[model samples]
Target: MSEASKHKAYAQRDGLNHVALVCDDLSSTEDRVPKYFEIYSHADYELGKRFYFHDDDGTEYEMVC
Candidate 1:
């Protein structure tokens, strides 16, 4: 097995409101959304979208955008 498979990450929960990302103004994070979650990159954070993504190790990050 390669080094990439030596260790892995997983999600601990699955449901609505799994995570809460508090921000003063969600719009500021617009440009950076893609680096994390590709799905919300063009969805317009102003629409009040729920975005999620995982790091290289598969650790999930859910943000209420």
Candidate 2:
């Protein structure tokens, strides 16, 4: 099959939703990582303040607020 023919459109472009980077210190992680996009969504859970942020590269991350 040709490369163009094998390519999937936006609707069919299936891939990873996001990557979870575990950190011992949430504060440090936020401080070091520059936010590419505004918080997509956040919530308070048993783990702590969960903040979901998206990047320009179509990647998302979850960190503590």
Candidate 3:
């Protein structure tokens, strides 16, 4: 198994609440993310929106605006 899969549940249990990567342009980032990752959820807040994704190994990530 991949290292990312090993920590999949751990990350969820710990409630990791930070952006893993920050991009200058979210639209550009969003366009490229699906090529490598699977987007599972998305939410729009007062400030902006967030896109949640996971890799093949089940590692999770969040992109926020």
Candidate 4:
């Protein structure tokens, strides 16, 4: 990625509340992401875990909550 792309990723992170990523197969993303970054909660919908992943550039985001 270019420097501009890196900057845009950080800028976009600032505007987001939480990334509600839709996954056809959560397993794939889950497997690649770290377990420590996972945020546990029962409020969002059902009683399950959510992954809080940071981009390669260090922008924080949530997955499959």
Candidate 5:
């Protein structure tokens, strides 16, 4: 079976709060990282805007929030 076939979904649960992505350098990670990810949904915080990057990474991350 393929990678996708190996996994199965059942039900939906509560939404996610936040995620942390590993990077060689957080400073440049934002600028250097490719723009393959797009905003699926978002919210505003006291610090800044929170954007959700949609990809095959299995989870969403706050890239430029």
Candidate 6:
């Protein structure tokens, strides 16, 4: 077996589904997001809406409901 495969247990195990963030000023954050990041997609959820974006380095981020 390869060396990298020996430490693959972490990824194979179950963990938290997702992380939730609480923003004090969501509207302000939403307005500023398009100036720096690329807003790629959006969708409506049961609670509210979600905005998906990526920065210059292409790291994915989301504004969740």
Let me know the TM-score candidate 1 reaches against the reference structure: 0.40
Positional deviation of 2 in candidate 5, in angstroms?
Answer: 31
The Cα error of candidate 2 at residue 18, in Å, is 1.5
Local accuracy of candidate 6 as per-residue lDDT tens digits, 2-65: 4223423123224532223545665777898888876666667786676665555434566774
- Local lDDT at 62 for model 6: 61
lDDT of 6 at 8: 31
What TM-score does candidate 5 get on C-alpha atoms? 0.38
Scored by lDDT, model 3 comes in at 0.67
Best by TM-score: 3
| 1-65 per-residue lDDT for model 4 (tens digits) | 76334434345545664455666556676776665453332124474445555555556565663
In candidate 1, the residue pairs with backbone N, CA or C atoms under 3 Å apart (3 or more residues apart, or in different chains) clash, namely none
Model 5: worst 10 consecutive residues (lDDT sum): 3-12
Could you tell me the lDDT of residue 17 within candidate 4? 40
Residue pairs in collision within model 2:
none
TM-score of 6: 0.52
Per-residue accuracy of model 2 over 3-64 as CA lDDT, tens digit each: 22332112221566556666677766665565445554546788687555656765666775
Best by lDDT: 3
**TM-scores for every predicted model:** 0.40, 0.50, 0.59, 0.41, 0.38, 0.52
Clashing pairs in 6: none
Candidate 1 structure lDDT: 0.47
Candidate 5 vs. truth: CA RMSD? 9.5
Q: After superposition, how far is residue 42 of candidate 2 from its true place, in Å?
A: 3.8
Report the C-alpha lDDT of model 5 over 1-65, residue by residue, as the tens digit: 54223321221225554464544444465554446664444445675544445347555465543
Q: What is the lDDT of residue 3 in candidate 4?
A: 37
Supply every candidate's count of residue pairs whose N, Cα or C atoms clash at under 3 angstroms: 0, 0, 0, 0, 0, 0
